[model samples]
Target: MTRASLVVVNYNTASDLRACLASAREKLGDAEVVVVDNGSTDGSVEMVREEFPWAPVFFFGKKGKV
Candidate 1:
């Protein structure tokens, strides 16, 4: 199987991120998921970390660019 990477940039949008992850999980199997939090104050990083522990989470500083 081919390996894939899913990169999701979150910015105070928790619901959308959850939905996106759910859909990704259903469609892509055995793929790596990466969630990049863009200094979101709505607990987006924590939510993703708790829900998708398998995925690697990255938190950028204020106005930080990737």
Candidate 2:
């Protein structure tokens, strides 16, 4: 079950990102999903990590990077 890589960037959009992730999971379950959280204060990173633990999440700081 090998599929292409999927990269999604999120910025304080928790609910919408979840929906997109759900759709991607359904359509491309075999693919690897990577979610890059750009300095979120609404707990987007936590939500993604807890709910979609299978996916790898990269979190950037307030400057959107280290």
Shift of residue 34 alpha carbon in model 1, Å: 0.3
What tens-digit string does per-residue lDDT give for candidate 2 at 1-65? 66699999989999999999999999997899999888988899999899999889999876556
Q: What's the alpha carbon RMSD for model 1? A: 1.5
Clashes of each: 0, 0
Which residue pairs in candidate 2 have backbone atoms (N, alpha carbon, C) closer than 3 angstroms, thus clashing? none
User: What is the model-wide C-alpha lDDT for candidate 1?
Assistant: 0.86
Which stretch of 10 consecutive residues in model 2 shows the poorest summed lDDT?
57-66
Best by lDDT: 2
Candidate 1: residue 52 lDDT (0-100): 81
lDDT of 1 at 5: 88
Model 2: CA > 4 A from native:
64-66
